[model samples]
Target: MVLNMQPMRTDSTIPRIVICGNLEFASAECESLFKGVAEVLVMNSLSSADLIEGMQPGGRYEGAVGILRQWNGFSHMQRAFIEALPSSVKYISSLGAGYDMIDIDACKEKGIIVAHTPGVGNDATAVTALYLIISALRRFSVAERQLRAGLFDASRVTQGRRDPTVRTLAILGLGGIGLRLAELVHAFPMRVVYHNRRPFVGAPEWCEYYGPGRLDEMLAMADVLSVHVPLRKDTVGLVDEAMIRKLKKGAVLINTARGKVVDEEAMIRALEDEHLSAVGLDVFPDEPTVNPRLLELPNATLLPHLGSISSDAQKLMEVRGLTNLRDLVLGLNVADLVPECR
Candidate 1:
């Protein structure tokens, strides 16, 4: 396929932008940063066909339409969405990272420019996951809750002869964030081991590689277990009751990946029964709201999905999305343009 490698030109007429998914967030970025370059259409829900049908009236977007969406869990309608769009929709930019949910090959077949914001949230999310691992291992959530509920001597329950600095850590799915976390974990001289779908090339010397079979074995030996895998059919619910049961007694669990990849109910039970020491979750099966049982338990450190919230990351995301869309409209070359599924 021929790739558009030209640069962007703002001299063209005002383009139209259709904001799908969360409009409030996109509008905030566009109104504040994008200015008068494009016509913005903010809609909460527009069916795949409806979106394309709307653009067909003029046979194409007024100039070029930029389609923006968030990392909402996977949707099968993606193929339909991409196929329906007239070759006129020049660019599809995901607001956050992880474009796995979108069909890239389909976009590529149509020469639609596809780009995702990567490395933007790497540091923020890596730091968040590391914090979660530490909090879970030390049972910080339990103490915080106990003290807030007018209970004294919360330390007895939280700091009961536990030292995370001395325990081993096993990371599942060593992507950018996982590697960053590994670097941080090494500072404490902790034993760090990881299992990835494929062996990572040029991994840091501090990380010991383990094949898939070793994953179960590693879990049984680790005191802190962190998950960093992307959500896919093969990986969804990768860890269930059986896997949790394999972990060392009082082992801590941390998940920064998609919530659906884990069985939330099972995790809660493991924490309550003390089969697992504690859990720090930054994402949930249902986001913006989570299971009430998790909130009621002190053994869980639940973050409101702020793993990617940082000034630098947010600005980078805005700039990448804006630049990608601008380049596609101007028929310029965009870096990291993902194609759609065949």
Candidate 2:
């Protein structure tokens, strides 16, 4: 795990880079971003033994673009591969803001630089959260299903949508996406409150800040709750049965954050008891395979992790990922290095 903070041999030469694991799920334009600027290699997702052939070090590939989704919960051999990368390879770039999937400690020990698209996904993801909030509040999913089932009587759909002006929105994490979503919804004159590790200084005048000690007060007061936190040890299962009990009855919950952040069974139970009116989720506890109970719930809006799925957003993320690689090749401060790495 030799660290290589020094610049690459020169700036004029094209850096040889490799795209590891699955590529089909990535943006279609991803490969073209490095055209004529870097020698690119595509490697299929394989177990440790399979990666040995044709994956040698020493200028064969000096940079790697790792798809976090593909690398989620990487195997031990994969960790070894990353740490044992050839001397020529010194940079690893993840597609988006979350680097939780990659073995960052291994990269750091190897003196490898890691970077991601920090701000590229904010707008798209915020828009998805907004969409979920509107749909869940209005119960549009239930109405659509009933309509498709030949029960088109508009009277059957409950007029349960809460007026934004009368509702209080409590944002759990006021990161990039949370701030953007606040701007998007404040037009409705919704009363906004947010809880963060520390108060967000220089916040908009309309938004209220709640420190950790005031969480119970915020939870009890919110008519709609939107979670925008990252997946970390402290946040996994952060919202559980006890926390749900604190929410306003019939409150709507929107989670565009990581699935593991909320307790799924507890949420399902609360929904079943009518304690929660509706739930909207773009992520799940076990991704690609959702809880069957959530699928059966009439009041739940489930999506296949669509936070950053837009074509435009996809391209922007790839461009940013590639740009980080370009910057490393030309010797620039890694702008989006994860805080822990820095």
Which candidate leads in lDDT? Answer: 2
**Number of clashing pairs per prediction, in order:** 13, 1
TM-score of each: 0.79, 0.84
Q: Distance from true position, residue 140, model 2, in Å?
A: 0.2
Lowest lDDT sum, 10 consecutive residues, model 1, at: 1-10
- Model 2, poorest ten-residue lDDT window? 1-10
Residues 1-342 of candidate 2 have per-residue lDDT tens digits of 111122223343566665544443343444455555555555443444444444554333334323232232232323677665555567777777777666777887777777877878899999999888888888888888888888899626557765566578899999889999999899887789999989776679788998989999999999889998888889999988998889999998899999999998999999999999999999998878999989899889988887987777876776677667766665778788777767
Q: Which lDDT tens digits does candidate 1 get at residues 284-327?
A: 98776799998888778889888987766766666677666756
What are the per-model C-alpha RMSD values against the true structure? 6.1, 5.7
Best by TM-score: 2
Off by over 4 Å in 2: 1-14, 21-37, 44-52, 57-81, 154-156
Quality of model 1 by C-alpha lDDT: 0.72
